[model samples]
Target: MPLPTQEKAAGMTTRGGSTSKPEKRQSGCGGEVKDRRTVEDRLDELLSSMLTRDYLDRQIKQLKMDIHAENKEITERLEGRIYELETDNEDLRKTVGSLEKEIESLHAARDKTEIKLNDLEQHGRKDSLRIIGLEDKSENESVEECVEKIVRFVTDKLEVSLNKNDINIAHRLGNFTRTKPRNIIVKFTSRRKKHDIIRARKKLRGSGQVIFEDLTRNNQQILKDAFRLKCVKNTYSIDGKLFAVLTNGKKRRLFMDTPLSEEYLMNDGNFRRL
Candidate 1:
């Protein structure tokens, strides 16, 4: 009976020891699982930081590209505006050139017309003469008869014969009034006959009657001014020009186009530089 009891006790002790070993192994497994969980959390944090940095870098690069595109667009617009202004400036230059040429052509045309009008006026009064200080005609006598009588008197005084056909037209210049009898204007058939009458006018020096070449209104004014000078002996108009005979027997020619002022007359009509 004693041997059996001892065997039973030994069996109990062996069973207790096995139970303690299994408890220790379970604690060590719990500690290993906690450490694995800590390592996984750290890995997760690192991945999140890398994703945020990549996103920020992409945004910065995109911003730089947008700025470059905007700058390029502004430059193109400025260049286009400059080209437009240059084109407008060139067109204005051409317009100014055309206007200047037109003004020059107008000036040339005006000068040519003035010269032509002067020639026509001078040719119209070629064969006419003016007779001053003639006696008044009688009331019963016709104007033609009065003119014939004057012509006969002139021919007798000059000792030169003149035909009736030589005279084309003769008449008083203005109305025949009781107070003032107008001078006579005569047109001759030929220029030679008119010149002959002018040459013969010297024969009637003492006579009250005076004869002159028919002058334009402008020439008449010039002659009247010239005759006012003390040095001027005689003044005559021929072919639209005035001839002044000085008391010293020198001849001076004057044009109707040039006006004679008081200063010029005071200088004895010496308009030349000499």
Candidate 2:
């Protein structure tokens, strides 16, 4: 009996039961279909947004790796360039120092050469001056010394003191006047026509390392004096007493008065008593 009743409720084909159940069921189906369509649409929108976000994230990670690699390469290149520059700078510094040393050495050599040249030039000038002095002088002595020696020799040998200035001035004259303007005189004597009269006159006129005039007188007294002093090993005696006698041939005769001797005179290499 209960089974029959349950079946009758499930089927509900009676007019009253069937009518109430169908109305209620129709209302719930309509509302459920609308809600199910809305939920499906929202799930589809969420899935589309998630796929786009994942793609963008992958691209961002790849870009970051590329940027990191590029920065590393740039840093390495700059470091290498800096290293090369430093090496070049060191080499340049060494070259500059070597060049400076070479320049300094060159300057030192130049200075040494200049000093040596100056010393040689100084010595050469001194030698040239000495040679010139020899050329310009007759006696080895200085001018004043020669003058004093000759003057004293003549005075002592010939018993006469000559005026120093007068002789000095006269000796410098190149030619003579009828009256000599200067008062100095040279007197020479030779009994020998064998005497090179021209030669003797030449020597006598200008043996003083100076120019002179030939204002000469050839005479008896001048000839006698030189003969007494010139002849070696001769008895130049007057009145049985020897006067000034010549002993050596090398000795030079100095006489203020030529013909100062009254002894024999040399003629044709023979002594003839006059």
Candidate 3:
């Protein structure tokens, strides 16, 4: 049966060898109707099959196109997200680096401060420094003493207008030697005055400060204390020479010692305040 069916299909070929069939008409009308019905059924089946196949192919192509479009959108979104994450990571790294640098600077400053503090503490005092009491010839330090000490120190001396506020009588030197100041510097708001300049001359009479003195006529030359007195209105030099004196009724005369040049003046600045 299969061979016969195959032969029938081969016989449908036309003279050009393409698949085609031709119909023959019978003399009877009924026989012709039956043959025509069979041909119509075959044609219907071929047309239905072609239509179904076309519809299925078009649906598959549409499904493939939709999948491709969705995949493209997803890939673009992921790429954008990755770019944002990379930028954020870079910013965090920079911030961390800056913080580390600041911490290092603070540590360096702290180390320098510690070294300076140690140096200062090392030079504060010596082991030989000690505290001791002073008597008649006190040590070189100011200390409290009784009124009897002040009275004994000023024996036979006519104390002038003694401003208690200005009087600073104190004992110094342990017992080896005692030094008393003669000339006193009196400071006022408007002017300055030197007191006991003559007194210092009296005190220096037996000391090394005076060169000569005549006790009978009270004619004498006195050494003014440069450490405690200023020769603003007086005419005296460090050489113990009094050039000009304030006469009772005459104007005081001043003579300028030869002026020293700026370079020759010994500008080591150690004796600048002196």
Strongest candidate by lDDT = 1
TM-score of each: 0.51, 0.29, 0.27
Cα misplacement distance, residue 70 of candidate 3 (Å): 1.7
Candidate 3, which ten residues in sequence have the lowest lDDT sum?
A: 211-220
Better of 1 and 2 by TM-score: 1
In model 2, which range of ten residues has the least summed lDDT?
127-136
How far in Å is the alpha carbon of 25 misplaced in model 2? Answer: 40
The collision pairs in model 3 are 138-172, 138-173, 138-174, 139-173, 139-174
* Per-residue lDDT of 60 in model 1: 87
Model 1 TM-score is: 0.51
Task: Arrange candidates by TM-score, descending.
Answer: 1, 2, 3
Top TM-score: which candidate number? 1
The digit string of per-residue lDDT tens for model 1 on 88-152 reads 98998998899999989988787677545654665777888888777775545566886786678
- 1-274 in candidate 3: lDDT tens per residue? 3354464666664445555555666656556434777879999988788789678899889999999999999999999999999899899899889999998998888867764553343223111111122124434333333324333333323242323233333232223444642221112121111133233335434433331211111011222221122222333432122232222222222112212222222233412232
**Deviation from native of the Cα of residue 263 in model 2, angstroms:** 81
Q: Which parts of model 3 are misplaced by more than 4 Å?
A: 1-53, 125-274
